[model samples]
Target chain A: MLTAFFRWMRLVLPRGDAILLAIALIASFELIGALVLLLNSKVSPVDLQLARTFFLALTAFVYGIYRVNEFHPLAKPDYRRWLETTPWTWRNPLPGGPVLLVPQDVVVLALLMGLNRDFSFQTLYIPVAFLSFYLANLMAINWLLGEWQLAYSTGFGLGLGGLVFRRPDYLLLIDLACYLLTRIAVQRSFRNFPWDDSHQPCAPIEASKLKGDSANHRLGWPYDSLTPAKLRIGFRLHDAICFAVLLGWWHLTLLWGADERVRFLIIALPLIAYVGIPLLRVFPYFYMHRSPIDVWGRIANSWWVIPKFDCVWIAPLSALMLNFLLLGWASWYEWTVRFRYFEVTLPTDWRYAVSISLAPVGTTAVSLALFLIGPKLEHWRLTGQHRIVFQRSQEFTEL
Target chain B: MIQLQQVTQHYGVRPVLRRIDLTIETGELVAIIGPNGMGKSTLLAVMAGILSPQHGKVIIDGMERKSTVEHELAIRRRTVFLPDKPWLPKNRTGREFLMGVGRLYDIPDDGLIDHVERLLNVFELEKEGDWPIRSYSAGQQKKIALSSALVTRAPIMLLDEPFSGGLDPSGILALKHILKHQVQQERATIVMSTPVPELLEELANRIVVMRQGEVIAYDTPTGLRSLSQCTGPLDEVIARLVHPRTMENLEHYFQERPKC
Candidate 1:
């Protein structure tokens, strides 16, 4: 019985080198804890809390990344190719072993819980953080691999996480729900076993080294002239909305759950998203592009706008305005979030969380809508109200 | 057979190809001729299914283009369209590109490699075929592109500006004979547009005369020759049919040349 348990532990844990690394990490943390004790009679409550939080967050992140990498075969080309040829299905014990959490996982969590036992029920927080990221990443992979179900795992985990500070009992239900839902999503994804180019790591042709002499290979306009650039077929409006809502939910949870310093990280992200995304995406189509007529020429001819071409900018511009409105709400509303006021000890209110969350939603929405709502890239490039000038390297351009 | 029924296309308010109605039989070599901006390429594009006509339909083997997924795929398998500046993969060797195109058309693997070699020799690209297409000269690029279209062995070939894109004298001559052979032996229907009236007269079974986005005339070489009332070769007659006042324009152009 003991041998069976040890074998199960071997399957659950990291390899030999990784195990040594984990031990070294725990020893370093213990050293830090000993230093605190040596310096003072006892560590301050605030310092103790901060140290535990940082360590838990770090451990959970590493654990989540390790599991996602190990359990997922798509990360490794050899495993993925082998799985494709095999008759093995997810119904069988994964050949590598069970992907779902077992008693072995509980023992690992129990060890972590024992280490950080000063805080009451700190065990629950470790599981919540580890499972949240693990499931979140898996669900994303699952969605990419063809399963459409998303957010159920991370949503319950992150949503209940904010309330966990006051009500730890409620988190137990979420932990259970997240695991079950994620398993379903993973099972559905596995059903799409023979994954295609969408999920598999695409071999970069530009970086490819073909057989034969690499000399005399030219680039640029050669390929572009033939295939042409059609920016039309990417993400669509609904996809943007879906992505935006998820980002917003993440922001909402983070705001309610984190300290003042972490809240500042989200502020620049949305702002950068608002200005940066549009410039990167929509501006490229219009930059140095040959318009059939200038603004003055259009005005003179009474041809005000080219709907097909002009419509491309609508998504980016509307999303910007919407983001501006959201910022305005955050700045002026009941629970105001002011930049550079982190030192002032501002109140962390529910209204502030909801207001700030809108920015992430708007930003993600803008980026996606700009990409997807289209006269397909081919249609736009071929028949757009512009001329395509040949570059110096371009012998000929087909538009 | 390839059929275009009332095909009209436009990018904006202004039309590129105006309500074109045309029929091309199997094994026929048709040439589209017109002045610049007369929609020769646009009409060909509509027929190639690259551009869907705003009005009317393109019918190939009684299967409408882009009508249903299965029909479109089947039609695509049986047809090959080479734009004047068709793209070539930069990293791929010329032979590799040809092999890829052959496979795309579902040609048998055992036969495809040999066919690619023969096509390379025909284009005088035996040595360069081992090199990447990106390193090819403009004329060489044109030859490889033409070879790619030929390698498909599709029943229908739509080539736009094949002669003028960039081909040496020998390259042009080789293409003329290869297209003729494809028609005579393989029973392939070819529609090409070129400024070279002499080449058109030599190879084309029928001639399509276009002007201002419309097909003004469609007939055989002898029929067009007689219709223009020219006793000499079809070249001079082509000038008259393409533009009615060619003699008047030439006389005036030379007379006005010194003054300008």
Candidate 2:
């Protein structure tokens, strides 16, 4: 686990100190926000402040030491020259090397030390921290319901470092196993592919060499030789799987939580129409440029938006269709069961139509105004030019 | 004139173009001839002002690096680069594409239609000029791209592998005529990079040979032959320089084979 964290930390930080500092600041601010939200609800004020200070200090300290130590893959063994050379790594002769410690592990240990008032004897009770965290996770699982339990195990555990607390003592061992799995899968899938040893640790290339040599590789800057079509298949597939899983979980959770069929339909309606259609790629991502030419044709035919007014008929038509579907289903249920019909009393007004038309227009005008003024405001504030530097070396080094 | 003084371009540490100096005079027809991956495209890109070099100055006329907007605009306006792979605006017809280029060059409305029509006729593309370029064959697409470059009367033309797809006799004849006419009328610097020695040898006023990202020789076809020490033909000399291994076998086969 420590090794993975070490690799991840190295991966996230870029080559230059300035970029490294900026990234650390960004992560630290996000961490601070999460901590503040966690503390604000029911936690004691003193405890909240202490926790906030501790997190900030820990983050700063870890990042600072890492920077000071120059714990970077790009800065050793003639780093400048290595960028030009084919990246490779030597085999680790010792299979069972010393287990690495992650930033989280160290933080936990530090917290334990503080709690026990054993600052001088920090390493003595590292095992206690691991055991307590594991016990907390195991106890937390019993309190979880069906979907929550699955969410805890997969999304929370696999994605957000919850799994680390479960088996903190054997964290390194667990990470090694996962690493082995990933390696085996990669090797089996790729076989003798060019990037077989791509993940192996290597040194950085010189800036001079990078500039000189990478000009003719076709993927050079100013002109990206990449075809957008090549990425579509994988991107679509991944998005579909993620959306399907999330929706399935939500539906299952709602089935357990809700009792009324209409309530369930109402909840599911927003998910399917507003989110699911777009998520599933059935509807296009953006409002504009999604079959722009086709939309223009529709506009010309008066099947879409009205000129100047820019009021789209599709939204209102779709809303009416949805309302009719719901109302019709309800009326059928009422007629069959001999229940009361409330449709005659319900109001249908033009105010809703007017508001709907105004909403997107108002929002779009505001957005356009913001977009035009944003750079000017930033320039005024900073007294610096609004320059977007797409430095490729930063990405390569960060990775 | 575009000047490259000691310009070198490297790709991931390997030098593609070594330190070199060259001046492309106005109306000069310079053809870059070299083996594949020999920085011919890089040279074209640099000359077109599409790329920035590592350790050299690329000045167009008197415009140095990031000097003035007017200079850059002038350079861009006067230059029309037909990339090796043509960028056909999908769903846009050939006429529209030509019109777009014409607009960019600020061509007069009265002359635009006539200019486009004439070039289309010359390239044998007038009948299908209204059709989307995506429907055209590779040869036809190349002709359209070449015609677009020609229509603008851009003083500097950088064509990377222009004669890639096969051109019919009439098309080839017409293209040669147009190029010759450009030199006579507009003083356009038609710099093209082609691996095919025969096509370039006939039209190229000067040929520049490159190897391992450096210019090996730059001279006229006859001058290049003299430098290469070839007696028979210019193509044979180029073959000897570019692909020496096949030359002996080719010579033997030609000598041994009965007169056809």
Question: List-wise, what DockQ does each model earn?
Answer: 0.08, 0.02
User: Docking quality tier of candidate 2?
Assistant: incorrect
Alpha-carbon local distance difference test for all models = 0.68, 0.50
TM-score of each: 0.62, 0.41
DockQ of candidate 2 against the true complex: 0.02
Measured on C-alpha atoms, candidate 2 has an lDDT of 0.50
Cα lDDT tens digits for candidate 1, A301-363: 466766645666776776667656664445444454457746333466654555566555555
Task: Give the clash count for model 2.
Answer: 11
lDDT, candidate 1, at A88: 81
Q: What lDDT tens digits, residue by residue, belong to model 2 across residues B80-165?
A: 77768655553446676676566546677579879999888888888889886667877887787778778777888888887776
Please write out the lDDT profile of model 1 over residues B159-254, one tens digit for every residue: 999887669999999999999999999999999997668887679999999888988889998888788887667778777887889877999989
Top model by TM-score, which number? 1
